[model samples]
Target: MQTVKYFTQDELASLFKAIKKKKSKYWLRDYCIFRVAYRCALRASEVGLLTVAEYNAQRSELYCNRLKNSQNNTIRLDDETKKALEKYIRDYGIDDCLFPSQVSKPISRQTLDLLMRKYCKVAKISDKKKWHFHSLKHSVAVHLADSGLDVKELQHYLGHKNVNSTLVYFQFTTRQQDNMYKKLEQRNYLV
Candidate 1:
């Protein structure tokens, strides 16, 4: 079984904190971008393609345009993401792209990778080379699976074209195995 690389909740919190401490003009935009990417389980390219119009403020929803033949879906925004997005939109007066470069183009995937590396370094996350922008998607998928989301549901949430694509996350981490053992113990299955 192949192990998926992902950020733990603690690491994600630390990363966001590091991003917040940065004094750059794009700080809020970067913060919101990462937050949304994690929450929506979006690929870096998908995130780059995001547009301001895709955010439905009144409905508190974001329409994700999935790539690589994945199904596209609209995800409801969490309170933190919603608030951050609203503030970013208001502060930046963004008209088109959700994350635009100075040249008025969508931020490139390479730029996203660089930003991830920069923030991971600032957060002092060990094995920083293992954590790329795609880790946000894997992190959310793993976290959601560990939270007891069903495979079908997780598949839909991730916009996986096939359940097999989502099944990799069910490989049972050590934490998940421990949980199973605890559940069996509570049922006296070992007896």
Candidate 2:
């Protein structure tokens, strides 16, 4: 099986910085979409289908209707994601689709793919070909897993119907294995 690829937190930060340097008017919208995807661990199609109506600003939550498995997930919005989305909505006067085309329609999957490529190029992400838009979702899962989130909870968070789907992401590499051991030792859990 091909190993799943994921970004480290520093790489994610670099991507956002690269997006910020773009001169396009859609930078805010793009950044908001990227942030929401990473934070919510959304699929590209799910992110494309997202509309402003899904966001409950008062509750700081998003009602995500994922396209692949027809899963309806209620995701809690972090303050950073909430603020970025709120500002994008306000600044762009976006009252309909969150990421809209010039024709005022939801951006297509192709467009989302192209956008990821563009930003990844700007960020100078290594071996970009091996990574896809779904890597953001993997990144969230792996990062949260490394931070000690229970696999069961991570499964629910990723909206995976099967626990095995979530388990694949935790198949650690040698460096990750070492890191996990070090973390356990620091917590005195090695005994």
Candidate 3:
């Protein structure tokens, strides 16, 4: 039973603001966790299970070993997300786990799921169940498509097994397809 939700940029920002107000370092913790999902389109379990060594600050790339998607991918980190991760690492201390327990144990996937629910509740967010932790990843892929990234480019970023999977990541209308086919037809002198 998995619920899926998409976060608009505004919604993502709102959640960040709500979580950042806390006095403890947990907010930073949650923020980095959020960025990984929102930016990389990684599954909740993949983000939670990530080890610290996977981050390459100089390259501005984040390596997420995905199980659900069954492929490991290197996600490019935008500046804002990179900064947030830097702060998280500085405050949380860089050990093995990016988000670790008090005893330095990696947080379980279930723990992150529960925490996100609590965060959503505090902010009075609705459709809360719809935006389960995995939606963050979905939002990222959708955003990439919305931003005009070509299907092949998005395919690699998402670590999808085939180009067909990338097709599902984007929303297409019949008119758009007809227009493209018409344009292709126009290119031939057979008109």
Candidate with top TM-score is: 1
**All candidates in order of TM-score, best leading:** 1, 2, 3
Q: Where does model 2 exceed 4 Å of error?
A: 173-191
Task: Put down candidate 1 lDDT per residue, 53-156, tens digits, no spaces.
Answer: 99999999999999999999999999999999999999999979999876889988898999999999999899765469999999899998888888899999
Cα TM-score per model: 0.92, 0.86, 0.81
Residue-by-residue lDDT tens digits, candidate 3, 80-146: 8899998788876776888776667776667777767777766556876544787677777767777
Predicted candidate 2 versus true structure: per-residue lDDT over 1-191, tens digit per residue: 54878888888998889888995878888888888998889988888688889999999998887765645788999898899899989988988888887788878767877888899999989877534788888889888877767778888888888788888877743445777799999999979
User: Model 3, which residues run further than 4 Å from truth?
Assistant: 1-4, 172-191
Q: What is residue 152's positional error in candidate 2, in angstroms?
A: 1.1
Cα-based lDDT for every prediction: 0.90, 0.83, 0.74
lDDT of 3 at 112: 73
Q: How accurate is candidate 3 locally (lDDT)?
A: 0.74
For all candidates, what are the clash counts? 0, 0, 1
Error of 3 at 29 (Å): 0.9
